[model samples]
Target: MMTGTIENRDVFLANIAKRFGRAPKTEIDRPTWQYNPQNRVLKEATKNELVEVLVEQCKNIHTDIVITNTANLPADLQKVVGNYGGKSVITWKDERFQNYALSSLMTEQWPLENIQLYEWDSEQPEENIRQAEKANIGITISEITLAESGTAVLFSSKDKGRSVSFLPENSIILIPKSTIVPRMTQAARWISEKVRNGELIASCINFITGPSNSADIEMILIVGVHGPIKATYIVIEDQ
Candidate 1:
């Protein structure tokens, strides 16, 4: 396995700094933009309006949208899985599933429905990838949701693998209403704040918009050619 070790990065930078007759800067102070236009778009939009905007954008991306509360999420999720023709499922081993009352989904519901469930095991990464590759549907909880582009920001940790979102035939995203932002600007700000606070960011941060969309040589629009064939966003109204 390649560790991607950069053994001479500091020395290389130091040589460049020496050629310029200056020391390498450890930090840079960027000028704040006097005119910020990103904060203006959907600035006045209410939480409900943001949800509406997300729904409208989903239409263009060919993604299914489901609005459900915490109480009905398990049932609604089951129905969605069935709609997507899912026979097996793969999901991240996240604690948020228990927080959102989905802990019994695999133990109770999927067992009753005779659907196989696979949880990503960090210790067995090879098996995890194989399960994700074979699973019919992959489900994940979004840490941040952008309403403008209908995008879900997922911060991948040891328990969260990116393959669960990309290698499956179908993708299901669970988005809480509280995590919905006006656009990517808010998401970027959140990440910047984390970095500024000297917090360790996840190794992988995924900005998944929808399923894989591709065009053929004839300009024929094809969905899910090499990635997930379908994607669904389940937005929780009351988290």
Candidate 2:
């Protein structure tokens, strides 16, 4: 009788585990920013100014920049980013990115030859994760990023595999101004749609708020302990 009861209990626990995903004991909370379309301060800001603000607020000891569009970068900043030994990775969605006009720093004569370009299509699950671990910067596009909480939704797809965004040391997300939404509930609705379409795998979905941080050691503050040390969102202005 005892053995049968124990087996039943074990089965029940297993069922619960299957339904709910595994995560750490604690998670870092992110700061939220409310969206105001009428606010001319944010809306009127140029891409350069917006990028500058992101860098100012988010930069820390570990700063790896992942840029989505190398082609469209301003000429002056190109030389500066190159000197920093930044890694460049391009997403496969050229048609969708057509509006931004992203280009690479590596050209015929001015070869940023050292800057490695990681094509999103070539990575497998394990390899993608491994590469991301070694890479300091991960630059990619967000379908509908939120300024409401500095949230960037990385929809998990085979083409974009999860690791490309999650595992890197630093993540620089490129969000066109048009995609910013006002609330988390709206983002949740979009996520549900993707899940229904059979695009997302794994029961657990992650929403990162800011750079990874911890104060475990004698209550001393430390950054980049659990995840990327820094995360910046580039709100590309269409205007």
Candidate 3:
């Protein structure tokens, strides 16, 4: 029988969260929106409709929308983005998912020659943030360690800057199907444990569930008032 030290991950996370002053709540109840896989539910709708849905969420507040598909971006839709004065950016995950390529923003045929790529690193978060501001669509990779709550926990310590995901007009996350999880608590626990063991540390960690939104203005529904007004999660099954 193989025996080893079993870390108290939950407790460890709790302590880390407490120290950070942003510990998530204990409430574990929420409605779950199951993304059907067998039929590819998202594909049922026209790509235009999907873009409309994302655009409507912005309420004409933000001009740019970020995305993460480059290699095989929808042609017609890409044209729309181009006409709309959108900028597309490119990002690729590490060796783990090297085959995947992503592009964002521009609707028209992407100028493959003009596309710029960035690798995840810690030292240039400020520069990344500056670039995100200039870009309408900010695309990047996800660590995807925690899957519950349809969240992607990206690391921006030195490899990837935190601002790459935040501080943009629209934030689109590309999460492989394998990384989805059922609860935010599970993610919190994992983060805490990792930090406790010196596996991860950073100035900030962003937990984005959906697009940037707030309805606090006199009960008026608003999105992207503060951060990226649009949030789209492209859940691609492991290939």
Candidate 4:
């Protein structure tokens, strides 16, 4: 049976090669051309300028943007959750939140007596997903932001589940200003370079532009059909 399957695969490939008028090669060849026109503009953009464009594009896509310094992030987070009346929040298990002292602030703002705060657990994924699905807000860290299209890139690991940013009514992303790239092409190049340099890559890389929406049923627009209805980005300038 295995030999028959292998022969069938070979026959399929041979047919494809014949249709293309070329011989099937045993090895794969990587492309040599890699040039993006936006790289120059991206390199010339100032941090503030990138933030401006990013905010503009985000707003255009119905996503909110908040600019805050590292020290004031906790306070801003409090405001955002307070405005949304979020009682339960799920956050990624990342140390950057600890470094920014968000845990303490979150406890103070949403005490154990009033709110439910959950963290993603790598070992207990099913439990984590269950908790995250019931949470009112999902908070995750974005390593890269594309200013040109207002896209935020997230690398998913055992510690950082993809559902942490999707299975909630509201999604909040924390991004540092330094990680803001000009476009998606640059972001792809950076990831490729990281892989080429022996850096450990995550199992999933998500590029989220805004809240999930669908308008397929009719001309009417609907939001949060597949993911969060509201998306907020907290851009830290000094971090």
lDDT of each: 0.91, 0.55, 0.52, 0.85
Ranking by lDDT: 1, 4, 2, 3
lDDT of 1 by residue, 1-239 (tens): 66777899899999999999999977899899999998999999989999999999999888999999989998999999999885899999998898889988956238435888999889999999999999999999998999999999998988899999999999999999999999999999999999999999988999998898898799888998878999999999763
Model 4 clashing residue pairs (backbone): none
Model 2 regions more than 4 Å off: 1-84, 87-99, 103-113, 192-205, 215-220
Shift in Å, residue 56, candidate 1? 0.3
Query: Model 2, range 107-182, lDDT digits (tens) per residue?
Result: 3123454555554554455666666777656666677654445566665555665566666766666666666555
TM-score, cand. 2 vs. native: 0.56
Better of 2 and 3 by TM-score: 2
- Residue 83 of model 4 has an lDDT of 66
Task: State which candidate has the highest lDDT.
Answer: 1
TM-score of 3: 0.53
lDDT of 4 at 232: 92
* Poorly placed runs, candidate 1 (over 4 Å): 1-27, 216-219
Ranking by TM-score: 1, 4, 2, 3
lDDT value for candidate 1? 0.91
> What lDDT score is found at residue 22 in candidate 1?
100
Residue 141, candidate 4: Cα error in Å is: 0.6
Candidate 4 segments whose C-alpha is farther than 4 A from its true place: 1-35, 38-43, 106-109, 217-219
